[model samples]
Target: MESPPADTAPQTPALTYRAPTEEDHARVLAVLDRWWDGLGGDDGARQRAGLLPRLFFQHFTDTSVVVERDGHLVAFLIGFLSQSRPEEAYIHFVGVDPALHGHGLGGELYRRFFDTVRAHGRTIVRAITSETNTGSRAFHARMGFTEAEQSFPGYDGPGTTRVTFVRELEP
Candidate 1:
């Protein structure tokens, strides 16, 4: 098949980033569904909703960020400032559309989150992922987070061990 003329080809859509609102809950969940569709069998399916609850998104609307191109939710970072550690912020969940993986979207999301939190007077950012999630561990390292303390046994529950990572933001 012949390719379309240069001017006739569609232009890549520009991604728009903004703070997520309560209205975006459905779209965000749908994006998560797509991103985690086949990963963890029955256990994964059951735990997905609880992992990033709708109520958390509704409550922490300001700190969260979502990126979209055209009208779809392409990536998201759901996070909030820590009440106990006033200088720290935590990333509760973050996901990028599988189609956009390896294109630096994840780093962009983390950068945006860092900027947002820093603007709010947060000096440190923290996040956690499963011990088995090597991909996430590497990504966090690339984003400037180092393992915080030691891996926690059953941090998420009875059987889930999690690796916590922390990044100190510039004031």
Candidate 2:
């Protein structure tokens, strides 16, 4: 039997998850606009990219995560224990390669973040998304997060309103 041609050969995905480092700041930022392109068009994507700042990588590396497949970034989650809320952790941002959505990568990243925060005594995890982002809302619901009764206006800016989601971790 002849082996399949290289072009037609099956390729197994090799994914690795690790805490993000300061060096990843630029790389992640570079992809944010593209990663979130679907959420908004070119201009909107650029605006969304501004949501994540270099400070996250600099200050929250210990609590953040990045996933790579065959050495290429496929997903990431930035989270941290809240300084003002001892029992709470906040998920600042999350992104999965658009090509690889719905493959459990996002959930895996969330689970890892939850475990990290849980180990640090955090009992609640919170996240927020634009109310128009139905995909995020559904994903959060499926992840066992409860939504707040109403969206918070100006949560991000003057005209921005966001839906908050919270999940209670088991002790």
Could you say which candidate leads in lDDT? 2
Clashes by residue pair, model 1: none
Q: How accurate locally, in lDDT, is each candidate?
A: 0.85, 0.87
Residue 3 accuracy (lDDT) in model 2: 98
Which residue window of length 10 is worst by lDDT in model 1?
A: 37-46
TM-score of each: 0.89, 0.89
* Candidate 2: clashing pairs of residues: none
lDDT of 1 by residue, 26-97 (tens): 787666656875456667656666687778767897888889899888988899999999999999899898
74 Cα displacement, candidate 2 (Å): 0.3
Q: What is the alpha-carbon RMSD of candidate 1 to the true structure?
A: 2.6
Model 2, range 83-131, lDDT digits (tens) per residue? 9999999998999999999989888889889899999999999999987
| Root-mean-square deviation per candidate | 2.6, 2.9
Model 2's TM-score against the true structure: 0.89
